[model samples]
Target chain A: GIQVEQSPPDLILQEGANSTLRCNFSDSVNNLQWFHQNPWGQLINLFYIPSGTKQNGRLSATTVATERYSLLYISSSQTTDSGVYFCAVVNGNKLVFGAGTILRVKS
Target chain B: GEEVAQTPKHLVRGEGQKAKLYCAPIKGHSYVFWYQQVLKNEFKFLISFQNENVFDETGMPKERFSAKCLPNSPCSLEIQATKLEDSAVYFCASSPQTGGTGNTIYFGEGSWLTVV
Candidate 1:
């Protein structure tokens, strides 16, 4: 099994601030995904970047597969962005998730 | 847009009772997975099926947790003699197929179970 670790386990910022979250995997992975669990407990897919970079709205993610690491960038944070961010990677047949980074945005 | 549908948004049961959760994967998806998240914490992989066939269940409890996927029907995850620790939000997800170099999966809203 592969071990996934997330950094800055907890983060807090003002609405207009910016932040970056990181994920590191112990082994090679075929699939990688970023998820946002909202206040209501709904898990929303943020990105499916196995490699390279992707952007959606104010959020962006970059995966360096060779380095076995990924970075998620949140710009101009908003109150709606307050939640837990999870980074998961496929290890063999099942996906293993990280401990997650809890982010809070103050209005 | 594709989505996984989970039934019974919330469930409450006794410690010794049985709890069953259902998930309907998106059309044409062949891989279904079940994961349990306790109090918005770490995700514990339970089981997965590749079109009615168990693909990998290494993380499953094996004794008290069982799951099944049938043709044209929703997949079901059943917990027998559930314990207080079994209370969590169960998430279901589906991908187009297995063994692909890059596969993107879609997850359901999740079913929250409360065991007293």
Candidate 2:
């Protein structure tokens, strides 16, 4: 039962602003993922970076496995990105998720 | 393309009634998972299947919850005698690897179950 904690439970920013969200896990993990739960409640896969850096459009993520931490960076945020950002890790057969960081981007 | 599909975006049932939800994993995926997201709580794993076989169901409430993955059909999770606490968003996810880093798990728009 590894614990995953997300920082800054809530975040608010204006459109076009950049922000960083962090996730810290308490144990080793075989896989790490960042998901965006949009307003429609769709969990969109953003990245599957277990121990490296990955970038996709305005979103990027980096996982430092040794340190048991991961960071997600969003640049030029849009209203569409206003929702919950979750980070999940695999602890054996099951994947555990954090409570998630609630992001609100105002236009 | 890499997305899981769930049916009946919303479900409402009376207390003590049975609630069933269906999930269709992405094509070629071998692993399917079911999770419950209660209010103010993180997603909790309920069960997982590896091609019709129950891989791990330790998280499932053995009392009144049951799940099945029929051959060539969408997997289903049924909750018998549903209660108010069972009212939450149920999410289904699928991945190519059972538990590997290549594990790009994709989830569907969860099915919200409201039991009154």
Candidate 3:
């Protein structure tokens, strides 16, 4: 099984602040995705980046496959952004997830 | 449908009972995937289907877990003799799997199961 490690197990920030989350995998992957688990338990897809950089509004992500690492950046955070963020990689036939980074944004 | 749909958002069962969950993948999508979130932050892949056929099911517990994706119907995951640890949020995801975009997967709101 492929191993995934997320940094800064937990995070707290004020609304409108900025933060970055990281994910590192032990093996190269064919697909790498970032997700935000909402309060209601919906796993929202943030990014599906195997390599290179992508941005969607205030959220952005970059994957360095060669280094087996990825980074997610959230700018102008909102109270709605408080949730758990996960990075999962496709290991052969399945998607292996990291433990996740818990984020709390206070207004 | 634009997104995956799961039925019975929450379910409660007793130990050794049978529990089942259902998911309807997006229309026209050919790939369906199932995942289990035990704790708030941990997710485990359960199975994946390429259309109506099983693609990979390495994460399923052979003795207690079974899944099926029959044509013209929603996919199902069944756990017989459910244990306390079987309590978790089961999520269903799907992708169009067309062109170069098939690898991107989308998830549903999830079905929460609890064993008391």
Candidate 4:
């Protein structure tokens, strides 16, 4: 089993601000994904980056597999971005998840 | 359209009652996973299936929990004699196959279960 830790457990930001959330894993992973759980409790997949960098609109993520760390960046954030961001990794057969970073983007 | 579809967006059951949840993975997906999220905490893996075979179920509670995935039928997770602690959001996810590298798992909206 792999251990995952997320930094800055809580964050508050005004609209248009930028922030970076990080996830650190204890072991090598083959699958890495970033998810956003909305206020209504819907889990939406944001990124599935096991390595390299990827961007989708205002959200981007980079995973350094060798370093066993991943970073999620939100640019020009909107109020709709307020929610809990989760980082999940798969070491072997099971997917391990971090506690998540709660972000509040005030309009 | 959502890749994974879970039935009964919300469920309420009395303690000691049996609870059953269903999940239908995306077409062509071979792997299906079930996770439980309590409050705002991280997801707890329960079980997974690859096609019609059970792949991994180490996270399942041996006593009151069981799951099945039959061919041409939707996958199911059943909890017998449910307890108060069983109240949580049950999420169903699916992927093309298993392995760490490059596999992307998609999740359903989740079924909220309240045991009283």
Candidate 5:
């Protein structure tokens, strides 16, 4: 089994600010994904970066597979980004998830 | 469809009752997975199927939990004699076959189950 740990278990920020969330895995993984669980309880895919970097709108993610760590950056954050951010890695055929980072952005 | 479609966004069951959730994976995706998320925030894998055959079910409970993905039908997760601890959000996901690499997977909106 693989273990995934997310940093800064909880976060609060004013709207328009920036933040970075991190995930570290205990073992090698071939698939890594970042997800945002909105207030409505929807798991939205933010990025699928097993390695390298990718950006979509105000969010970007980088995965250093060799280091077994991944970083998710939110630029000019919005209140809509408020929720739990989860990083998960495929362990065999299942996705092993981190405890998640809760983000709350104030107006 | 481009997204995984799960039925009955929310369900309520009493202890000892049965609960079932359904999921239709994105069209053309051959692999389907199920995961459970408790309010405490940890997501646990439950089971998976490739086409109509079970793939990996190491995370499923010893009893009362079962799942299936048959041809031309939506995948299903069934819980028998539900307990209070069975309350959680169940997520269904799918991925294109990527050999053994276990590539990217997309998740549905999740079915929220509450047991009383």
Candidate 6:
């Protein structure tokens, strides 16, 4: 089993602001995914970076496997981005999730 | 285009009653996973199935939680004699057999279960 810890348990930002959320894992992982749980409880997959950098629209993520850390960056945040961001790592056969970083983007 | 379909967006059941939830993985996916999210906490993996066989079920409560994935049928998770703690959002996800960065896992909208 792998332990995942997400930093900045809570964050508040004004629209157009930028934020960076971090996830630290205890062991090496084969699968890593970033998910956004919207206000309505939909777990939207944001990125699936295991050990590289990837960008999708206003969101981007980088995972350094050797460092055992991952970072999620959101630029020009919008009200729709207000929600909980989760980092899940697959260790062995199951995926373990982090506590999540709650973001509040005020418009 | 790729989506995991879950049934019963919301469910309410009395204590000690049985609760069942169903999930249909994407057409080409071979792996299905079930997770439970309580409040705003991290999701807890309950079970995972590779095709029609159970791959892992380490997080399931041996006494009350059981799941099945039969060929040509939707996967199902059943909780018997549910308790108050059983109330949470159940999420179903799917990925390909050769999972990695290339094969990203997708999740369903989740089913909200309230046990009173």
lDDT by residue (B1-116, candidate 2, tens digit) is 45788977999999999999999998888899999998735899999999999999999999999999989899999999999999999999888857434577888888999999
Residue by residue across A5-79, what tens digits does model 6's lDDT show?
Answer: 999999999999999999999998988999999999999999989989999999999999999999999999999
Docking class of 3: medium
Q: In Å, what is the interface RMSD of model 2?
A: 2.0
* Segments in model 4 whose C-alpha atoms lie over 4 Å from true places: none
Once superposed on the true structure, which residue ranges of model 6 sit more than 4 Å away at CA? B99-102
Second chain TM-score for model 3 = 0.94
DockQ of 4: 0.73
Answer with 1 or 5, whichever has the higher TM-score: 1
Give the Cα RMSD of candidate 5. Answer: 1.3
Tens-place lDDT digits, model 4, residues A4-78: 999889999999999999999999988899999999999999999989999999999999999999999999999
| Leading candidate by lDDT | 1
- Cα lDDT tens digits for candidate 3, A48-91: 99999999999999999999999999999999999999999887
What are the per-residue Cα lDDT tens digits for candidate 5 across B9-94? 99999999999999999999889999999994988889888898998888899599999998989999999999999999999999
DockQ of each: 0.71, 0.66, 0.57, 0.73, 0.65, 0.63
Residue pairs of candidate 1 with colliding backbone atoms: none
Ranking by DockQ: 4, 1, 2, 5, 6, 3
Residues B1-116 of candidate 4: C-alpha lDDT, one tens digit per residue: 34799988999999999999999998888889999999967699999888988888889997999999899888999999999999999999888866334688989989999999
Alpha-carbon RMSD, each predicted model: 1.2, 1.4, 1.7, 1.1, 1.3, 1.3
Per-residue accuracy of model 3 over B65-107 as CA lDDT, tens digit each: 9999999999999999999999999999887773113278888
Report the C-alpha lDDT of model 1 over A57-89, residue by residue, as the tens digit: 999999999999999999999999999999999
| Global fold similarity of model 6 (TM-score) | 0.97
* Candidate 4 positional error at B88, Å: 0.3
Residues A1-107 of candidate 5 have per-residue lDDT tens digits of 78899999999999999999999999999899999999999999888899999999999999999999999999999999999999988867678899999999999
Task: State residue A79's C-alpha deviation in candidate 3, in Å.
Answer: 0.9
The sequence of per-residue lDDT tens digits that candidate 6 reaches over residues B1-116 is: 36899988999999999999999999988889999999968699998888988888888998999999898898999999999999999999989885333478889999999999
Error of 4 at A44 (Å): 0.6
Mark the regions of model 3 whose C-alpha exceeds 4 Å error after superposition: B98-102
